[model samples]
Target: MLATIERVLILDRAEEISKMVLQSEIAEEYFRCIYKVKNNLETQRKIREFIKVKEQYEEVQRFGKYHPDYRVVMIKVRELKREMDLDEHVAKFRIAENELQSLLDEISVIIGHSVSEQIKVPTGNPFFDSSSNCGGGCGSGGSCGCSA
Candidate 1:
């Protein structure tokens, strides 16, 4: 266990590292893309529409198939999701966001491994985890020859 002074020093260094990260290329792109997404009128309108549909979808989910509008709400949610995913600004923002996540994950992995190679560091890739049953879409209900 670290002492209070040691913890405070680590936190101060962490803030410096965070500032360096925000100045990096991927982080800069992430900020820029998010700014566009927030300011674009059409995208904001579409997002508002999607939020309304999502709320309706959530309500339908509470009743499952028993809800009279279940099928239609599900379809609308999927379609809206697709449209949002296809938007150029949204797509770029998502890509930057993922890239930034990957960078942070890498940093975490380095820190964890530095402390102890046996420590568990989640990199969001099952293949990197020795305890995972299978890394081939098993989580999506597809059989990957692993007994569940």
Candidate 2:
């Protein structure tokens, strides 16, 4: 039930945060690594191959050991995965991507906690998994962050 002006202000602040993230060193490195992965033809080819093999492996997995080609398909998938992981640019890109994701997760956790620690924000990091703690107490403003 926010008024138009309040909604607009919130939207504006979101835009500002987006800009700040885009300018951060973590974000910059993420973009650089992603660009390298995107432009590398060998990586692109391997990615495509991996996707195809992975899908086939999934199909075989549904049948468990009964699938005649399960072992063969699984072996091929693992081999392709190793190749993909060995690529320098792909490895760097994955690291950068994970770092950026962690940064964004932290910001999300902060915003959620500010409103109320009772709010459950799912950051994949085990250290930030405060969904159960709820800070301290209910609403005495002990640590449950709600300021009312």
Per residue, candidate 1 scores C-alpha lDDT tens digits across 1-99 of 757988999899889989989999999999999999999988887788899999999999999999999999999999998888888899999999999
RMSD of 1: 5.7
Question: Which residue pairs in candidate 1 collide?
Answer: none
Candidate 2: stretches off by over 4 Å: 131-148
Q: Per-prediction TM-score, please? A: 0.78, 0.80
Candidate 1 TM-score over all chains jointly: 0.78
lDDT of 2 by residue, 10-115 (tens): 8999899999999999999999998999999999999999999999999998999899998899999999999999999999999999999999989998888888
Which candidate number would show the highest lDDT if scored against the true structure? 2
The TM-score measured for candidate 2 stands at 0.80
